[model samples]
Target: MDTGRRAGEPLVRHTVSPHLTRLLIDAGTAAGLDRGQVMRLPGFDTLSVDPVRIPTATIMRTWEAVGGALMEVGGVARVMELWRPGTLGVWDYLFTAAGTLTDALRASGLHFAVIADPVDAIAVTRDGAGVTVSWDGPYRDHPSYPLIAEFVPSMFQTVASSGAGRPLTPVQVRLPHRAPLSHAALCELYGTRNVEFEAGAPSITFTEADAATPLPQSDPALAAILNDHARITVETARPVVSWLDRFHLALETAVGDGPPELARVAHRLAMGPRTLQRRLNEAGTSWREELERLRQRRVDQYLRETSLSVESIAARVGYSDPRALRRAIHRWYGHSPRTVRQNPD
Candidate 1:
């Protein structure tokens, strides 16, 4: 809902997502912000605020400060209570009609289009043997992107676990360039291997095998049930997870060549190292863990899916010494790089 701030008013009057309003409440308390002051701000209605009326920039700022606080407080689940039941039925129809993950993404993009806060764009591409689904648009500040990114994975996971389903493993993301701090929050949330910066696109990638897997129709009754409640869970997780996805993409793009030092990452994120650490901690992860996770995942993917040698793969993923890289790989997967390459596991 629009807060109706006039020209020259402080940015506080910007429209805000209901999810973000909750996050601000949590963050303000954690930051020692006075609750009375927050509630006094224009458009401070805790309930019934229009999602579209909230400005994207305001949401971004709130997310940076709050990180995953809303999800931690169950704000997302609570927000889901507002969605119309028909929303889920519509999503189910799209899920069934789509033939692949790529297809599902495209359909989702279209479905969001009728709404005022639709996804910017969804693009499908082939990287090596995998398919990438890139989503970009004004969602930079909206809670939907993060929520969608997080929930989509679960949706894929659910479909996969259901037997003969196409489960998605999130890969890289490309986010807008301006807000590095916002990107940091995103990286921690999605746990993706890479986060590209200021790229021409913002999207997620899926393996070809995963993308090609058909939707399971074996349990029509069960599918319908799951569909009915899909929006409920999606509403809760969208903001936090989507922000993380964008952050991961930014990190991947920045450090794609080598492991970025804390200072460098902090610089990219426009915050001091200490501040970055504090914010990351609030998000329930550390920079070191995120760096290592990206490295290990990239290393494994290269070894298993590509013909790149250990030395070459090491360099591509930012490792300088093949031996050192081997140690890292062993530590992560409990097997040597050569072993992995030979067996292609």
Candidate 2:
């Protein structure tokens, strides 16, 4: 049998287990919206045939719709409230079956690609006495990114705390987005109030001792079986490139030495400058827009997370003129660089 995927197939950049999509839809229903209303929201029309995977882009669009629908009802808090552990299918099971939080996190990290794509964007590292997990990617531009940003760490807390049989607070938490309207919900979820906004990326850190604590539900026999299944799943569904993610990767590399030039990015992507521009246009964005957004995020991070001078930050982000950077800061944030740095809230 020819088991290879068909030719001329499009690459799905990212995907989630169908259960995650169902969770999003269910959140909308729990918020008093009819099921039809959620399904009618953009990107729910395509049904998943694989039973395990659903396009994450579809979920992203649906998230925006659900957030808008729930804006008046309860917002992201309601979604988090409705979310329950063990609803994530195999991904969740891998956690409970593991011997300790550290083992579970490592296993989850290894099999994450089975549930989502662009697997390299996530990093799991261990310091002397702490383990840190972080996700840094082009996903910040998506409207639903902030919602997912907050939701993910909270979910991690819930799962880890429950599995460990004790509350394990993160040593630190960092988010790239601004703080939400209600900190109460977040404080309650993480079991800690030490959350920093406008960070370079989304990350959570826990002490190594906490991570090594054994879980009561650990079942090595079942874990071995699930590990085999996860390995098979990841091997079967290889990571596929998304053009948007590729562009982001190229842009990030290009911006290291200096400003990101369209020609340089195009060459990096093995496409002509014109073709890249056309692709961006078709995606409802342009090179200038993405460049500006990237610069804004970098500038914001530098201002909030560093003690760098405005001139230094401007040069770092490719602005030759410090005054120009100041004007951009005012335009984007309605404040001066100094003000933004001091009062990120």
Candidate 3:
């Protein structure tokens, strides 16, 4: 029985393990971005070095900020340049330790959510002469979806090639999103000239021979240990579904579209405004407090992560008046936006 495929309620919110975010941070730093400065930026400053779960929105925002920075310095392709084995910790080892590429791909389907998110986003299937690994889920709505879509397939290819102990090119690579302005770097990285975009989903297919290649690092004992750790992590880290989580999701969904309106959010959640307020109060928060917190985080993110002017950021965060935004920043952090941007930590 494939217990990993058991049906369950969907998560009200999604989370990513910290190492993925660390990968982006490391890649940004390798591309010449300041580690301290990037880490001090709003969405990243709070992340722990330990393997705690990070909110998907936080990771998304950080990727957007860092990916943009990397593009200016050396192109986002630098992330692949900085990649190496063991970057994913137990997850990476699980693949290399598997008896064969086939086994590694199976383990990926089983244990991926232990390190990534949208629990069942990865699907491993046999296609006559090829094996396909698909990544598609509720990730489309994310602001960082395009980067995530591109990153996942490229990262998977890297990991699979490392496990196979050879440079194994995909049979084909398909992405659901529109092609980027310049996907030549992506084509070169994926070892293909034309990567299909606007596909049904994000997937990579490998020839059956490549899928069966024995990894040089295969050790059943190590594989067992890593599998145990992954299973335990997946079981214990399953996110709890609750109204509070739902509320947070609603708020995130409205980010950048505008300030999250109370009535609209409540409607989305299938509850009256009063009921949503009551639920928040029960959860030891309120709409105003939550909105303010969201605003403050966005303000910090923009101030420190990018070169966007204050007036532009003010409008982005739904602050029509720059002075009002300044006052709010002062109230939130006891410092001007400039000071916060300069000394984010």
Candidate 4:
């Protein structure tokens, strides 16, 4: 009960992740609108679209637009069904983070899956003495063990602090695996001294008083809305065919006014050129090759299908001189541009 003095201070606010932007686009698609159309919808065109997060207000406005459009079929519940856990962006630090716990509980039940497994979810429970949050799911050797192990206790600390209005350290912390690297740093980061390394199931335990304390910042209404949105976002999600196709789409979007370079295309995709190159490498391709391929197709089209002079066509495809274009054309085909045009293949 002694949560260090001041009682009426404000809590931190967290922004929604941009993944919800993808969700809004999905909602538009469900209502038979293309992404461009949705982006063009008032209050959205000016917003900078990121692949990770977007403004919560923009999400609300987008929801109004998409939700309104879909009202004819079945209203908000129809929209809610399409929401997924990934779609629910972190609302705020402890406030929103706690809601995520509730949302995960709603989606996964008592047990939370550290990774993915619809049938055998993770368990989060409480008993006569204290509360226990557990993730004893089947993925013991899951790649996310380190991440989830760190995240669970950190989150409990957050929920406790927010609920008690002070830094309420956990009474006990347990890890499913060995303590992560940089052990000294972990203690400093978690600021907790009662950690049990390799406790098998990775759980957090808080005193009965701290666990029962009210999170005044908690808003059940907002949590319900977010949970619904998260569910719906997952249901109607569309998968990107491949990184190459995604790059092509991003490139095409970048070249709206004229020819676009690799940097410009990378910027449009919300990544730096180096990061883009690495991702492309993982996809077994290179940016230079993709750009060259796109240019080749455009150049061939200009030569065969359009009446633009060869010099003008050269400029359009990024060549400075007609001679350079001619040399490249010869490299592409054994004959001159005129011969290729005449042959029409």
Per-residue lDDT over 1-345 for candidate 3, one digit per residue giving the tens place of the 0 to 100 score:
122651221431376667778878888777777788777654464466444555666566567567656766655567766777777767777778899887887887777776676443677888675888887666464435566677778878888888878888888888887776777877887888758999977888888888877789999998988888876665555443345656776787765565558999999899999999998898788998888987776677667655568888777776667898999988988998889889956
Best by lDDT: 3
lDDT of 4 by residue, 117-236 (tens): 222334556666466555544323222234445554654455445434576556677776666444554564456677778787766666667666555556677656654544444333
Model 1 weakest 10-residue run by lDDT: 1-10
TM-score of 1: 0.36
Instruction: Judging by TM-score, tell me the better candidate of 2 and 3.
Output: 3
State each model's CA lDDT, in order: 0.49, 0.69, 0.73, 0.51
Residue ranges of candidate 1 with Cα displaced over 4 Å: 1-39, 49-61, 64-99, 113-116, 125-128, 138-167, 175-198, 217-345
lDDT of 2 at 131: 79
Identify the candidate with maximal TM-score. Answer: 3
* Model 2's TM-score against the true structure: 0.62
lDDT score of residue 63 within candidate 1: 38
Model 2 bad stretches (over 4 Å):
1-12, 41-43, 46-52, 70-75, 180-182, 234-345
RMSD to truth, every model = 16.3, 8.2, 7.2, 20.6
What are the models' TM-scores? 0.36, 0.62, 0.70, 0.38
